[model samples]
Target: MVSLKSLFDLSGKKALVTGGSRGLGLQIAEALGEQGAELVLSSRKASDLEKAQAHLAGRGISAKWIAADNSRDDDISRLVDDALGKLGRIDILVNNAGATWGAPTEDHPIDAWDKVMTLNIRSLFLLSQQIGKRSMIPNRYGRIINLASIAGLLGSTSTTQTIAYNTSKGAVVNFTRALAGSWGRYGITVNALAPGMFPSKMTKGTIEQVGMEKLTAGVPLQRIGDEDDLKGAAVLFASEAGKHITGQILCVDGGLTAVLSSS
Candidate 1:
């Protein structure tokens, strides 16, 4: 019989998490670190990354911080190179770096659309491509977990009109499928995690303006997602248990996508 602990253990694996300074990326990094993976975390701000590294170390996890901006090609290249140099290998990659902009369809700025697309879609693909081409492809073993959104799977009734965000996330879903299909034979698995409403720096202001009760009322589970919500799915994908699963979008939304009424 397979021991459950063994199935989830990542004793010697090396993981690189983009945008891991705070919010969902940090949460995912913490989860992966708890599972015994050596982590290389990157984000835009050096100060925030240092603080995050300290926090992870306090939890008894080995972590390294690299200041990187995903929006720039040079920064992304340096990030991958730095991780490879420090960690020796990147067995797992969590492309959780993303950006969002909101505006009415009619008034949305072209620059905002470009920004969202570049960060959320273009950079994600480029980074993943680099990791695969330079590291994972040669090793013939890799696990990639993309941070997609329920916004990609379904439409939202919320007041914010995030047209570019929705479009970018939708692209992410398809990209996961395409990459998974192509890389499966190479012993690589590409998948996506679609999250529902969660409280983070991104949503804090929105929740404050709309109130928690109102937000919770729309979730079928009657609550927003928490840090714990990010752990199980991540462990699944990164562990031996999820080896057979690929090219799929696992929705972590609280039944919000399944049920018509979130009320």
Candidate 2:
């Protein structure tokens, strides 16, 4: 019989999470740490990374933090090198770092589009390539979870106004499929998680401006995603439970994607 603990155990695994200083990334890092994986968290801000590292340490989870902007090629290389130096091996990678800008497609600034595409799509692919080629492919074992969004799978009304973000996330979903197909033979599983209406620093301002009722009312579940919602998905993808799952986008959207509401 397979024990529950054995199914979720990551006792000796080393995991790296980019943009892990706060919000969904931090939550995922905490979840993986609790599951017994040595964690290395990275973000652009040093102070935020230190604070997050302390929070994880207080939970008795050993964690290290690195400050690096994912948009820079050199920084991306340094991040992978630094993580490998500290953890010896990267058994799992959570590509949770991303950014978004709100602007109408017609009026969107060129810089905003460039920034979002570079960080959200290009950087994610580059970092995944570095980890897959340099370590996981050689070792023949690794789990990669890319953080996608509901925006990728469905269209938002005009009020949201983030075409670039939506486009980049769509790329993420397809990228996961392509990578998984190519790497599965090497014992690597690549997947994506599309979260819906999570209240984080990224969405706090929007929620405050638009009001929670307006947001929750649209979701079929009538509630926003919580930290608990992330734990199971993260653990499953990173543990034995998801060994056979690959090239799929798991939507943790509280039934938001299932319903077509004219509200």
Candidate 3:
């Protein structure tokens, strides 16, 4: 019988997290690292990566970082290679690099749409393929977590105009399911996290613009997510506790998705 501690232990795991310099990515990194997983973090900003590296080290987590723009294929390739070089084999991967453009549907820019799709979906595919082919498939063991959003679960709202972001994440939901089906034969599990409103750099402007109370009023929890809220869910997907779970999107929302919109 597996001990309770053993079920959640991630010691000896080598993990990679994109966009790990800040926001949800950083939070997930902390979760994995705290569970004894050696981590490799990547993002576009070297300064942010440096800070994140220092932050993790300060917490006694062994971490390495790479500066790469996930939207670029060449950079993604380099990132995977460098990550493998640093970690040797990636047992877990967190795809969290994403971009969003908020504009009226009629006025949304084509370039912005392309930008969101490229980072949120295309880059995730490229990195997952590289890592899976190089490590997971051969070893017959891996855990993959994608960062999705509640917007993907529903259509665009009049108040928030992020058509491209919504579409990209909707695609991510299915992508996780489809990939999980293909990779299960190799003992790999793929899952996604659909987080609600959390105060992060990415959502700060939108939260402030819309007002936190207004944004969370529909939620049963009646509050915004704090820094520690996502760590447990993230750890579950990356550890043995979730070994049998795959192709599922776990929403970390404050019961917002459970309630039907009055409209």
* Tens digits of per-residue lDDT for model 3, 106-172: 9999999999999999999999999999999999999999999988898887788999999999999
Deviation from native of the Cα of residue 110 in model 2, angstroms: 0.9
Which candidate has the highest TM-score of all? Answer: 3
Q: Give me the overall lDDT of model 2.
A: 0.92
- Over 1-263, each residue of candidate 2 has an lDDT whose tens digit, in order, gives 89988999999999999989988998999899999999999999999999999989898988998899999999999999999999988999999999999987789999999999999989998999999888999999999999999999877458999899999999999999999999999999999999998989889878998898888886878899987788889999999989999999988888888885333
- Specify the highest-lDDT model's number: 3
Worst lDDT 10-window in candidate 2: 254-263
Per-candidate local distance difference test: 0.90, 0.92, 0.93
What TM-score, to 2 decimals, does candidate 1 have?
A: 0.96
Error of 2 at 177 (Å): 0.8
Residue lDDT tens for model 1, 1-263: 88988999988999999999998999999999999999999999999999999988898887998999999989999998999999988999999989988788888999999989989989988899999999999999999999999988766345868888989999999999999999999999999999988888877877898898887786678988997898889989988889999999988888888885443
Q: Which stretches of candidate 3 lie over 4 Å from their true place?
A: 261-263
Model 1 weakest 10-residue run by lDDT: 153-162
Ranked candidates, highest lDDT first: 3, 2, 1
Per-model RMSD to reference: 1.6, 1.5, 1.1
Assess every candidate by TM-score.
0.96, 0.97, 0.98
